[model samples]
Target chain A: MEITINQTPFKLPQGASIAEAIEIFGAEPPYAIALNLTFVHRQRYGETFLTQGDALEIVQPVAGG
Target chain B: MSLPENPDPLVLYGTSFPSRLLLGTAQYPSPEVLRQAVEVSGPSFLTVSLRRQAAGHNETGGQAFWDLLSTLKIPFLPNTAGCHTPEEVWTTAQMAREVFETPWIKLELIGDDYTLQPDTLEMVGVAERLLKDGFKVLPYCTEDLVLCRRLVDIGCEAIMPWAAPIGTGRGALNPYALRLLRERLTVPMLIDAGIGRPSHACEVMEWGFDGVLLNTAVAKAADPIRLAGAFKKAIEAGREAFLGGAMTQRETAAASTPILGTPFWHQNPS
Candidate 1:
């Protein structure tokens, strides 16, 4: 199945979890994940499975005013 | 009534901070300069935002910046700078809380792209929801009295009103409205955005604002580190001046030297 990470398209194996997506995305530490505009807790990454075309945001600290 | 014995520390939502200046971690010349600026200023809080970890961009995607911020040990005040709606603010704030592990949020909802003004109409509702979610929300709003009153009514502990448009460095554009907001609302008010110089920060601080938050003023300076120190001093000076009480203004000029002691002093007949 293909899912989007940070709005970028990527192909993952069927039933791939958010944790797997994070690993695939190679996101750095001190980041947070939001699945379809909902916050996915860190511990729920493994149990939460991603379906086709699901949007996930891997966000990290950036400079802001 | 006499002022509190110890009012030096600026208080917001039951938390006390020694410094009244909050710095933004953006637009610094370099990471090293930012670090030094943080050290010199000793800001009460440092503002940060969250962004996507784009492909092949991890090198500058904030891990190193995070590492640097961690060592500095300043409390983080994550902002939802670009969100335009309640849902966007809600999601962005949740992500910020998860990443920064702090309940404090600088809620920013941009209504206009050109001026980057806060959508005063929608912000009250957004702030209410965030407050219900157990977050300490500091709303970035205009100098409008009614809007700020509504925000306070919705349980915002502190309010941040723009001194001018974001990044323009124009300073407080509406003194009358800002002063009215200051007088009407008892909550802590911080002048955020549109601050170009230390004097700009000082001017608002002298108006009894609780603090000042800025990114461009110090970050864009030719000497950001030195400018940070200057801001720190200016903030303190302004606060002190406000507390010490300034003389009243009058149309007639008052002589400092006593007329009796002046050698060439003469009274003019009306």
Candidate 2:
């Protein structure tokens, strides 16, 4: 499946859950995930399935003052 | 003079803030925890900064944070903290408007690298441009009465005077100047930066500041959520006290007793 994550497209295995995509991208655990403008809860990521053209955004907090 | 059943509403640039506490979205242990702390703080205004990711580096995933903020349905006050020039600040403000779809910006133009102080000249310049562009400019500046007046003259909607250097945690260093600014400035005045604790925020409110903007003080606390709530309560109490008008103090004897000592049974006849 072709998915756009943070404006960049990437190929993922068919019927892949968000959890698998995170691991596939080697994303860190402490990051937050948003799929299609909605935040997917951490506990629900393993069950939340993704499809083609899904917009995924993974955000990590940075030091700011 | 009494505390209202609900918090008083503070309106800035057309948005109404029930709680005078403005929170920063930074330095939390995690985004989840930051959201929790923001909830605990009960802030109507949240501050976020704009910065470019490294060159050609595209994937920041910053949308998740924005998603949460949208869900919260609170007014987001995007800040120009890192910008040092008027052009940079103006550009960042435009980007923020593009991304957040809001014209409200916390304009911060740092002058020196060491202290991270605001450049009064650049701040005035950018503020004039932003105001003319219809952006609500909340300039983060020093406690200079003249500079503040200049910003107001240039059409800034609000003035956010720093208590001290950014993230210094030194708390309010110039209470007198802050008090004067609060009294003098016609628009809303928020004491931003160098607030280390809830008490500091309370003190600023008690000194008649219109609002408080703090990030590191709550986000870096041992218990971020709890401390956020603490600050919320403290600011409320302080504002209440300020409106209630605290009793005056006396340096010398101006008491019930006269200068001459009264006899033991002097009041018996009365």
Candidate topping lDDT = 1
**What local distance difference test score does each model get?**
0.90, 0.79
lDDT of 2 by residue, B1-270 (tens): 976555567778766668898888887878788888888888868887654322232222244555666677777788877777787677667666655667888898989999998998777987998899899889899999999999888787778999988888788999888888888877888888999888888889888888898898888889999999999999998898999998888888766867476676477766
Q: Would you give me the overall lDDT of model 2?
A: 0.79
Stretches off by above 4 angstroms in model 2 are: A1-65, B1-7, B54-61, B252-270
Score candidate 2 by DockQ.
0.07
Error of 1 at B209 (Å): 0.8
What TM-score does chain A of each model score against the native chain A? Answer: 0.96, 0.91
Query: For candidate 2, what is the TM-score?
Result: 0.73
Clash-forming residue pairs, model 1: none
lDDT of 2 at B84: 76
Residue-by-residue lDDT tens digits, candidate 1, B1-270:
965655579899999987899999988888889889999999999999999876555433477878888999999999998998888899999989999999999999999999999998899998999999999999999998899999998899899999999999988899888888888989999999999999999889888898999899999999999999999999988899889877778999888877777664566555
What is candidate 1's CA lDDT for residue B80?
A: 98
What is the TM-score, restricted to chain A, for candidate 2? 0.91
